[model samples]
Target chain A: MRVASALLISAVASGCSGNQSALDPHGAPAIHMEHLIIGIVAICTVIWVVVMVMLGVALLRGPRAAADTAKSEAWLAMTVVAAVAATVIIIAGLTIASFYTTRDIGVPKSDALTITVRGQQWWWQVFYAGADATPGFQTANEIHIPIGTDVHLRLESADVIHSFWVPSLAGKQDLVPGRSNSMLLRAEKPGVYRGQCAEFCGLQHSHMAIMVVAEAPADYDRWAASQRGDATMPADPDAAAGRGAFLAKPCAACHTIRGTAANGTTGPDLTHIGSRLTIAAGLAETTRGSLAAWIADPQTLKPGNNMPMVPLTSAELQNISAYMESLK
Target chain B: MGAQNRLTERTIANPAPAFVAGALLLLIGVGALLGWLRQPRELRLDPPAVADLDQFRRMPNGISGTPPESYFALGKPYETDAYNLSQGKRLYTWFDCATCHGDGRGGAGPSFLDGWWLYGPEMVSIVASIRDGRPHGMPAFRSRMTIEQIWQLAGYVQTIGSYTPKIAAPSRNDNEHTRPAENRGPAIILFDEGPLGAHPDQGPSP
Candidate 1:
């Protein structure tokens, strides 16, 4: 029993230490929260132990048959004093921690990048803020930000309520339907972190995940620059046929690829889908096979998703997949 | 004995106090229920839309008494129910109709809430247009949405430019776009300045 208890305790302790964990924070806000959680857990454990010890003592030593009045009064006064002291300390600590953390986290920096993230039913419509000279480009699912730079996200929902939560980076903020909310995120290190729609949205909520790729400033800029360009035209005949098939089919009705007739906005923008890390709202790998399968039967992969199953022939599906692969 | 002396046991000894407390709570609950029941129904803020089948009778296709081919063969389901209209509105947004149609004011496609429709102002015509997309723009949705959904959308579309019974008052959180009143004809609205100099005979016409 002792061995099993030790193992279980270790497992629980290590569970929140993953790369995408709040306990293993990579950003300032997450770090603060992690400290706060640790402090709370420690204080609670101590309190529990003290309470248990008192219960044990009380049980082991029965109440006095004839208690001395002065001694009993002294014990009562001690207990009350200790309780009041603990309460005051706890309240002060919590208030100070909350005020500091709330003020610091999501505080916009002068050089912070502003991005708009529109939460669809099961996908993210991500858009970088446009400069005066350059129009903003739209992408889906994956968000690339510069490492160590504050990133502000304007959260909006195209449909139901969804939450933006990157546990290692920042706290969760709800994206309510028909209203816009904002949250700030920053990554201290250059690495990939998984994000999820923290809200319990409709079907396929588990599949509605996102990836945050924190790259170096130069790399992020290069990615942004490349993404701003229209989807590259496929040179291969099969890919060309795929593009043709895409335009000819109902695919064009709900997706958009810049510089093509497939300007649909009901779904996520596919201008840079080929270059993305994952597809189907981070549910599948970004591969030709997965892309083809997703296009063939979106309903199967994500039931109740807005993208209906488009009846495409096998050859056309392959062609479309090729064209999609050649998009970058 | 000392501990017992220090602490005093409290009990509800008076029945009057208990009865009075219970009565007050009951009265408050009854008052709240009555107030809620008497509250007036809120006005709906959805765009004015009415799906009347009478408009279809004016069409040549309707006069011939021959049902049009493809989806919505059973004819447009005149759905004025708030829930159904909201569903149709969701479909319209989901289908990305707002992209080309500029939130009901003309953009790449002609405005649905404006005068001078390229196709006649019949619900059936709207259904047909959606089924068979026009040239230059307007992607066909026949393969995507179900016929029932198309009919619902047609019902919602018909509501534009028409008065509707208010259901709920508009809230500040509502982000749905409302059509501007000065709905310039499609040509002007599409280009933002003047009509596209394209030949009037191009593609289908009203």
Candidate 2:
């Protein structure tokens, strides 16, 4: 029993904290929700224990005399009154929490930066909105936002259905085909939060993951500026050869690399693919070797995906992989 | 006792044997209909024809000392059988080839039924058009579609105008890469679909 109590306590402690946990409450919205959750749990637990005690009393003491029967009737009436009072209090508490949560999460900010996230079959296509002074650019899989800033996400799907969910940052929003949904998010501090498609989309639905990078305002500005430009040109011969090979082959057919001849919309944008943390929708690490193997046989890594096995010679693969890595 | 007797007499009037027999016959009919629907559909139509395939094969492109052969070096990739054509038709729709090609009558591109050639009238040219897509319009499918799939699509395109009523795939024209209903496996085939029959480069119908 001691060991069991220890285990229960540890589990509860661990549950209340994690980098990706909603209960941990990294930001204002999640923290607000966390308070309500804790209140509800405490209230429910107390009520449950009281009801169980009452049931035990009623079960243990059986029939009695006439005077005892009259006392039992009075006890029953008191229990009913307590139950009604508890119900009213619980209902009032929940109603206030719901309204407060909505008010905190739904209030839109005028200066919030809008990022359009389009969900595809097994990947994410991210596009940052351009303002009057700055031009917008396209990236994929990963999104970087400034810490403590209201980040508005305009979610849509190119095909099928997908849900964008980052437990630490905000609530889950469904991306339905032919329809656009919007949600707002704000990170309290600089950290990387993992996210995934909460909806069951298709075969590789499990592989459809997301990475949200919360950085300092200055760092985010620098990153955004870099992404706005074309992929840095390769300096060396082998790297240049890789670039040529990428353009010559059908790699351009489904992928787009800004400022390069490889513009095809069927696949993810690879302009900043080299800098991504993971590839194949977070299935593999983003490395030159992984990229080569992915190009050689994508189906082997992610089955039932639309990416065909690109037939490339070893030397060509090496060069192309090098060029891809040099995109940063 | 009276209630029990009445219940027993009613049950006797209804009769379990006749009711069971009727239900059994109904089940048999349903099973037969399902079997008929699931049967493999076969084709009785002639395969699409190509004019002067030999002449096109003989012409050298001057580079690499190797003559430009068809993508499917093994004569015909499929047997042009009913089952194969039906799969090919489904693949055509699966790959969204109908989006620009108008199911073969041509939309953004030229009509395959008109027999007019922007590149050439040979079968190799058609395969080449798909392999390395034509400039400006057709997207290069070499990297996106497997070789066998390309062959299947080519076969389906060849049979476009052969029938008056038109042998067509079900139009699922959406951008979704739908799983083929026939369970022919993944949309992409990495391994060889079948063994080559002695490398048809030597002659036709090896």
Candidate 3:
């Protein structure tokens, strides 16, 4: 019994406190919900213990003589009423709290940043809705947001039903075909938060991930400008060769690269791909080796992914890797 | 006498049995209530950390039919030396047909490998399907694949349209000249469902 109690205590403690590294700079809503849950659990535990003790005593003491039957009946009635009342209160409180936390929090009446996310089979397509005449920027996998600002996302699906969830940033929003849903999120600090598709799409669904990078306003503007094709590429022989190979192959048939001959709208835009921290929808860290591996055999890394294997010689792979590395 | 008998019966009745039965019933009722209360609240019960829920939603709509007998009849001695059905297998994957056909069992789409063909069993009808496409959701592949490739793909289909994987013939050697005669599986045949057993004209029927 002592060992069982110890194990239960440990489990409760660990479940209450998530991975600190993962929860750092989490928005107020998530933190608030966590505390509320813990409080509810503590109260329920106390009630459970008291009820059990009372039940044990009642069983051990045995029924009193016929004279005490009225008192026993009254006690039983009170216990039932108390349990019912407590359940109602707890349910009502949780529902209300969950509603307020998920509702739009302090979104300014002024124009908000609007982004559209389309969930495809095992991938995410992100499109920035630009103001005025500027063409909106398009990207995949990685999402960037300005720190201390409200951002609105319009979620949709290309093929199946998918859900967008960034546990530390916001609640999940479903992406359904032929319809769109909206969600609001903001970052309190300049840091990176991980997100993933919270819907099972296909064999490669696990590989679909997104990086939410919170940057300062100025840094965000710079990144946005580069995404608009204002960024210049370094004039290196290896990178140049890699660029040539990229344009020559079927990569151009699906992907779009700003300021280059490769311009296919079927897949993600690679205009400023090098600046992103991770690749393959957050399946791996952004490195030459990882990128090379993904390009060589996407199915091996992310099974059932749409991207087919592009046969590249070892030398060509190295050259492409070097070129992509130089993009940042 | 009747009143005395009733009093005696009441006194002889065993109270323990009645108490045990009542207790058992109460226990069962309480257990059921506890089970109901333990159910998880409100949250969607899908698997955690799913990458693409969209893809999963779309898959169920495809491949909704029953599997055909031809798939199960593969590799038998009588079934050998028949038409090469490999073309259908290639077509199955190429056209994303498996998405609906689903391993040849009718799922979202009608089962082609089965003896029953909604249109007709004739090659002309199948070829027409390749040209015009079906009403529900099947797309015409005329614009997508070359005639030669389609014919080759169709040739492969003939041998294995009902070819279930369990009794699949051993992989064939691609080189025709070097392969031994005994090793060669079957003679490729192109047949028309209609009277003409030869290739038809390209133009649509008037």
What lDDT tens digits, residue by residue, belong to model 1 across residues A1-328?
A: 9999999999988867776789888887788788888877888788899989989999999867656889888998999998999989987987897788788885586567899899987889898988999888999999999988888888999768999999998999999877878788888998888989999987678989999999999999999999999987889999999999888877886789998999877878888788998998888889999999898767667766766555567999999999888888
Model 3 lDDT tens row, B13-48: 767789899999999999999988652321111222
DockQ of each: 0.09, 0.16, 0.03
Q: How far is candidate 3 from the true structure (C-alpha RMSD, Å)?
A: 15.0
> Per-candidate RMSD vs. true structure?
11.1, 10.0, 15.0
Give lDDT: candidate 1, residue B85: 55
State how far residue A15 of model 2 sits from its true place (Å).
Answer: 7.7
Give one digit per residue, the lDDT tens place, for model 1 in B1-206: 86665554333344678889999999999999998875232122111121222223335542123123321433223334444455567776677777887666768887665444566556666766676566677777776664445655765665553333233221121464354321122223333322654435433222
Question: Against the true structure, candidate 1 has what lDDT?
Answer: 0.73
- Best first by DockQ, ranked: 2, 1, 3
| Reproduced native contacts, each prediction | 0.12, 0.25, 0.00
> Per model, how many backbone clashes are there?
7, 0, 35
Local distance difference test scores for all models: 0.73, 0.71, 0.62
Please state the error at residue B181 of candidate 3 in Å.
Answer: 38
